[model samples]
Target: MKLPLFPLNAHVFPGGKLSLRIFEARYLRMIKERAGKEPCFAMGMLEDREGGAEVLPWATQVRMVDFSQLEDGLLGIVVEGVQWLHIEDITTDDDGLRWADCKPVSIWSEPNHEQDASINSALLSLFGQYPELGKLYPEAAGQSMDWSLQRWLEVLPIDAGNKVSLLNQLNSKPAFEFVNNLLHQGDP
Candidate 1:
């Protein structure tokens, strides 16, 4: 399906929350046009070079869950990712707004119930120490290896290319092992 694209320098995994401030005229118009309609958009990582945005091929389909005017006078909107998307074609308008033809990609499956207690405790500690991040989601749903791995991948300061590579893996075992190693090494 064709959808409006909002490319950013960040990544959000399925079931993850992302907060954004919209001020650009094109995006504002995009929001206005889609208000009460679908309330969904495609978010892709952008590599800013010189004067252009080189958007990543993979993106997440996020649905707007909440919106309000921030104290700083910006339109603050929070969205939760619903699924993965692969951009098939894209075209930019005169106003610099991009519309993409994308296809849905399957999300990672739930992992086996072999979670490490220490890793789980460390993950919980992160939320306890940072209350702001904790407030974004409903509650601690990362008890599973899949959820914990996805959350780590989302917040890690890794490059988008590497993230896409990891995300495209057919099985979650490799990703789980990667997160397990990080936790064991105290990389949090």
Candidate 2:
């Protein structure tokens, strides 16, 4: 099926958090109309521009998890990425937005259980060092992890391109490892 596209600079994995500011009239109306039925949207990292905004071949679908109104009357919503989709065909609407027919791709899991465990352990260790991040992810500090990895990813400062690159990488182990290095670098 085809869906509206929101080209961004970062990548969002399934279960990742994506907070967005909604200002366009069409999207505002879309949010108002689909708020209850399907308050989810898809995001893709745009490729080199041809002059105007355009949709790329890859995108991630996300669901709205929180919504708030800004003082200026604009809307802001936090969304969680659910899946990655591959664009098959795209068409531009009058407003210049691109809509596309796409298919979702299967995510690759670490081939070895030990690698999975290692990545999880590394993430836990990394999260433990950042107490301040607990304010943003309280549950991560609690007894056990009930939330998905994507949720934790949402809070990271890694941009859309980085997110997409992680998603497109070989496997989860390397992805988390990359995150570990990036976090360590940012930690000072």
Best by lDDT: 1
lDDT for model 1: 0.78
Q: Whole-model lDDT for model 2 versus the true structure? A: 0.61
Which 10-residue window in model 2 sums to the lowest lDDT? 140-149
Please identify model 2 stretches exceeding 4 Å from their true place.
47-54, 109-112, 115-136, 141-165, 183-188
lDDT by residue (79-173, candidate 2, tens digit) is 66777788888877877666768888855443423223433454556657865433334454332221334444544665555555655655555
For each candidate, the alpha-carbon lDDT, in order, equals 0.78, 0.61
Top candidate (TM-score): 1
Question: Candidate 1: where are CA atoms >4 Å away?
Answer: 48-53, 109-114, 141-143, 186-188
- Candidate 1, residues 1-188, lDDT tens digits: the string is 88889999877878888888999999998787776556378888776666876898888888888899999998988878888899999999999999989999875544355666665566677767878777885566545656666777887777787778778887676776777787778555
| Candidate 1's TM-score | 0.88
